[model samples]
Structure formats: C-alpha cells, structure tokens
Target: MAPQLTSLYTTSFLIALFVTLLVAACLRAINILPGRTCHSAKAPRKAAPATRILIVLGSGGHTHEMFHLLRDLDTSRYTQRTYIVSGGDAFSAQRAVEFEQTLEDRASETRNKATTVRRRGTERPLCVGAEHFNIATIPRARKIHQSLLTTPFTSLVTLVSAFSPLFRSDRLHPNLPPTTPYEIAAQDLPDLIITNGPATGVIVVLAALIAKFFNLKGCSSRSKCRTIYVESFARVKTLSLSAKLLAGVVDRFLVQWEELEGEGGYVGGHAEYWGILV
Candidate 1:
C-alpha cells in the first residue's frame, strides 16, 4: 500500500508539473505575440543612428522577389546587412554578392558627384563594401522529397541553428572595437528581419520569437528582431503556406493583392495590403 501510494503521488506531481509548464508557455505567448493593430511600435524610430537588417533569402522565386523589394534600400541608415541563406543554395548567396556590388557602384557614382560639387569637406562613409555585409547559411527545415517523419527532426535542428545568427557573433567582427557603429551593429541584435514565403524564413522568424519570449540578449526589452513578412506577389487571392503559418507571428504581414488584405483573421493579426511591394 505504501509503495502504491508513493507511485500515485509521483504520477500526480508529474502531471501537475506538465500542466504548470503548459500554462506558463501559453501566458508567455499571449504577452509577446503582436496584435492586429500593434505594428508601428515594433519598428525602429527614425532617430536611430545605425540599424542592422537581416534578410532571409530562399531559392528561385522567393529570392527573386526579395531583391526587388529591397531595390530602394538605403545603405546609409541601414549600416549593416546580414543575408541568411539555406545550406546548398549557391544561387542566393551569389545574388546577395551581386546586389552588394551594385550598391558599391552606386556609392562610387554618388561619391564622384559629391567630390565634383565640393572637394574640401569629408563625405560620410557608405556601408556598401564586404565588411558592411555578411551572408549566413542555415540548414533547410524541410527539403524536397524529404520524409514527413524526418521533417520534424530536421526542422527542430533548423530552429536551434537559427538562433546563432540572430545573436551577435564575434567571429564576424574579429579585432574590431565594439564602439564603432559597424561593430556595434554586429555585436547587437538585428533591428529588422525581412522575409518572403520560404521554409527557412519561417524557422528563422520562429527562432526570433523564441528569443524575444525569453528576452534573449534583451531582444524584447530592446525591441529588436522585429520581423516583416511579405507575401509573394504571385498569390492574388490566398495566402501561401508560409504566410498562413507566420501571419500572426511576424510584426508586419504585407500582401501585394487586395483580396488577401485580411486573410489571417483567424489568427491575431490580419494581412496588410501595401499595393505590390515586389
């Protein structure tokens, strides 16, 4: 009777512990998740001197659309750019390099014009070179023709790996003083994370949410890792699988078509139509 009572008490304690943990997780999700109208506050204010932006790129169409959206990116304000690509995607990595090259060329032309205007004063530096940008590679959460049973395991691995790039990595800025704006951007959390519909993108954003939930590296306290998810322009009436999963999780959910403006009503927030961002 004594042994049986002890076993029963152990079972009860285990059940109580599980319930407590479940409740705590629910409460945390409620506190940190963004609401329908709570979008503007998550963004960095104009007064910020330097901001780091992380861009998640996927293969093929997703990669093509992302660069188009960032065609007007201002290198002066967004001092540091981090491009996250999935493993084995050389095309996306190459595209990022080409994009930076274009920025460099544009900067050179602007500098030449500035020099012609006035040769005496020093011009503010442009963040276009290799030092100002980095490309990080993470494993794909789900691969083509992958087994469903193994997908969850792969995705779990991806979720864990995603945190490495979100936080500051000293390897990327070796021997540099932390006081400089570029180094500071490297040492701190990203101000913004931009993504389109990609499996890797969803995992990366999820990792950011997890970090914010625990206030990892002051992510939530400092209001960093704010995400903007743009639905693919190809989707006119319906949201893609990735968009459906992340509509509520991302800080801003943008859809190009009017029909998908309020698509995520079932979730906390709704899709915002910005009129063909891509």
Candidate 2:
C-alpha cells in the first residue's frame, strides 16, 4: 500500500511539471510572457533623442583637441552645444570667438541641409545633431575651500559678478563693465556640459555647482551634462591633489599618449596603440 501511494505522488508531481512547461510554451506563442523573454524579430530600439549636449572648451590647444571629438559625435544621437571658458593664455578671446562661430556655422549648415533633403523626399534620415549649442564664455573663478579662518565672501562676490551677465542676454547693457564672461554663460542652462582641461576647469566646476543648485530647486534635471577632459596635464603620472580630485569628478577622461603604456596602451580595458576617438 505504501509503494502504491508513493508512485501516485510521483506521478502527480511529474504531471504538474509538464503542465507548467505547456503553459509557458503557450504564453510564449501568444507573446504574453510576463518578463523579458519575448524576442522580437525586428531591429533593436533606436537610441534616445539627443536634444542637448553641452561642450565646454578651455583656451589653448585643449579647445582644438576637444573640437576633434565634438566633430565625431554622432549628430543623430546628440545635439552639440558649446561653452567657451578660458583658463590659460594660449588662445586669445578673439580666437575663441572665431572657433565658436565656426562651430555654430557648421551646425547651422547641417541643419539647413537636413531640411532641404527632407523637402526633396530623400530616403535618408535627417539627424539633428545639436538642437542648439548655446555658446557662453566663462571667466575664471578660483575655488577656495573654507579654512579655519578664511571665508568664501570674496569668492562669492567674484562669482556674482561673473554670473551676472546671464540675466542680460538681449544686449549687453552699456552700463555693465564689458560684461563678465560668467554672465554670458548664465544666459541659459544646458542639457549636457563638456569641458576640456587646464584653464576652463574652474568654469566647469562653477557650471556644475550652478546646475546642482538648479536641480535641487526642482527646476532642471540632475546634472545630465558630462565633462570630458582630453589630453590634460593631469594625465601625467603625478598630479596635484586638487587636480586629482577634479579628475574624479569628470565624466570621461582621455589621454593622447600614455608614456608608461606607450603607443598601443591599454585604455578603458582595451588595447590599442592609438587612442580610439569616440
């Protein structure tokens, strides 16, 4: 009697297992799987819209270097905007203006061409690389951590003057002292902010702080802008404490030549002599 009862229980368990499998197969056929097991035969989903991208460039060769990367950004996936912050004397303000203008012109031309093509009924898709790259110039503002006796009053005053111009975008009032650089940047916030190294680092820091404040106030999204430091002096094996700390905050870091790793160095856990620009 005991053997017979055990056999009956084993049969019931097997029947339950078979029923579960049958149900799963039926659900799959009907495309009603509860989880992610449903596999579509179509292509993968397209990337999210790149409505905004902020590119911050410091004075000197760094600006030129960052531009190279900016040029490569998949316009289909990004709307490139620019911010110019001079930290060093490598490029004069005039030169920076020229660079900024060149970028704007390129963006405009691309947009016009896309519109024209669409009007022509072309099959190619038009990618809006940068909806707007609002260019803002940020003057230098030194960061001074509060010490036992030192106050940040002076720094606060400096920032106020720098950011004051953000309020006056229509026209530089004749009264303002030639308009501080920070005022220009404050004119508008960005979706993503990118910065190169050396001079513009301070401006990047300030921009981040401002973004954080706006986010805390619930007006903007948490800092979606990314800062990219390319071929920075900090890339050297030894870096100042402050520089090291700054590196930690930057979103992505790129080095042209790795002296220790030499050409074909290992970066991003990938091996290549020449740094892949992406």
Candidate 3:
C-alpha cells in the first residue's frame, strides 16, 4: 500500500508539471502576438513624418517629474508632442506652455547654430501658439482621497472623455478638410505615453489599452501607443492606490522605490525599480 501511494503521488506531480509547462508555452506565444485582428505582426511599419508623444501631467510632483523627463527627451526624435491634464488644471497648462516654448527655443538655437542642418535650411519647430504641441484636458476622474466606490461611475465617464482628444480636430488646421478624430488619431496617435500616478493617468492608460484592443484610432499597435507608468517618488514602502490599480495594465510599470519592487500580485510578474524618476 505504501509503494502504491508513492507511485500515485509521483505520477500526479509529473502531470501537474507537464500541464504547467504547456500553459506557460501557450502564454508566451500569446504575449508575443501583437494586436490588430487582421494585422500581421511581421509586417514592416511605415515611419510617419514625426513620432508623436503624449505625456500626462498629474498636478504637482507628477508635473515636475514629467517636465524633467520631457526636457531630456530627444526632441529631434519627436516631431509633435501632446500634454494631457485634468480639466481646471491651470497650473499644468501653464507649465506645459512654458516648458514647450523652452524646448522650441532650445531646438531653434541648435538649428540656427548648426553648421550642417542649417546649411540645408531645415526649418525648426515654431514656438508659435504651440502648433507642434497641444494641451488636451479631460475632466478629473474623481477628487483625490475620495472613496473608491464613487470612482467607477466617474471613471467610466472619464474613460469615454479620455478618447475625445484622440478624435478631436486640430483647431489649428482649419484650412485642412474636416477630419474625424478617429482618422486623425489613427494616423497620428502617440507612439509613447508617459505618466505618474493619478486618477487621470489611470483613465488615460485604460483608454489607450482599450483602443489598442479594439484596434481603434490606429493606436492598436503597442509600438504606437505604449504606456509607461512611473510610481510616485513619494511612495516609500508600498505602492500608491493609483499605481496598484494600473500595475496590471500598463506596458511598463516602474516603481520609484526599491523596497516596493517585489510586491506580490503584480500582473507583469515584476516591476522595474528605477530610482526616483524626479
């Protein structure tokens, strides 16, 4: 009887091991498969005129982190940039205006002084009224520290409004024919999205993921609409509520604190611990 029991246990262990391996293999294949119902992951993508980027600004510290990150980004690599902020956030809008103009001026000086590119008369991005940049506002998902229950309804409403900017016509180009937001967003949706914790980040990130899932607004490709969520520097030992909620969905989840790096239940299995984004 003892021998029989040992043999049964061994057999069961082998079956479980085999099942686990098979499941892991299947999941790996699915992970590599890019989105788009009829799209081929192997197909070559056409490079657009310029790479578009969207940066979400959360009121105070988040805005500071983003501003520093934005300043360092190779502006030459990004032709157009968009800043997303919650409605009534005049501070964020003001920061964006000031920061974008600074960027423009810096790039212009580089161009004006360049012995190579300027010889070819390559035009620099204009500082004028932020033509190459836009400030998009969506209603706040819910006020800070509010109960989680009230959020679902507000979050749902915020989710729909989050997509509005992607569909909005560039009021700048009135001479251009009337264009649907989907068409415009599909053609020029951001290739990269950066954000720190906030209800605003949660909504926008979810919207981007949903858009990619449905292959709507041409942001279906992860390469075209990748989301990077950086946990707040203020978080020391544990993740903030916003980061915890977004950990499962965002493409890259970065934690500012090293101690919280190995928190359990992270959907990606691990979080990259990049010390202090600010």
CA lDDT of each candidate? 0.86, 0.45, 0.69
lDDT of 1 by residue, 176-244 (tens): 568777778877899899999889999999999989999999998888998999999999987899999
The alpha-carbon deviation from the true structure for residue 179 of candidate 3, after best TM-score superposition, in angstroms, is: 12
Task: Tell me the TM-score of each prediction against the true structure.
Answer: 0.89, 0.47, 0.72
Candidate 3 lDDT over residue span 68-119, tens digit each: 7666666655656778889888999999989877887787777677756535
* Candidate 3 residue 166 C-alpha distance from true site, Å: 3.2
Ranking by TM-score: 1, 3, 2
lDDT of candidate model 1 versus the reference? 0.86
TM-score: model 3 vs. ground truth:
0.72
Error of 2 at 48 (Å): 5.0
lDDT of 2 by residue, 149-187 (tens): 433554455455434322222233435643433333323
Candidate ordering by lDDT (highest first): 1, 3, 2
Report how far off residue 57 is in candidate 2 (Å).
Answer: 3.0
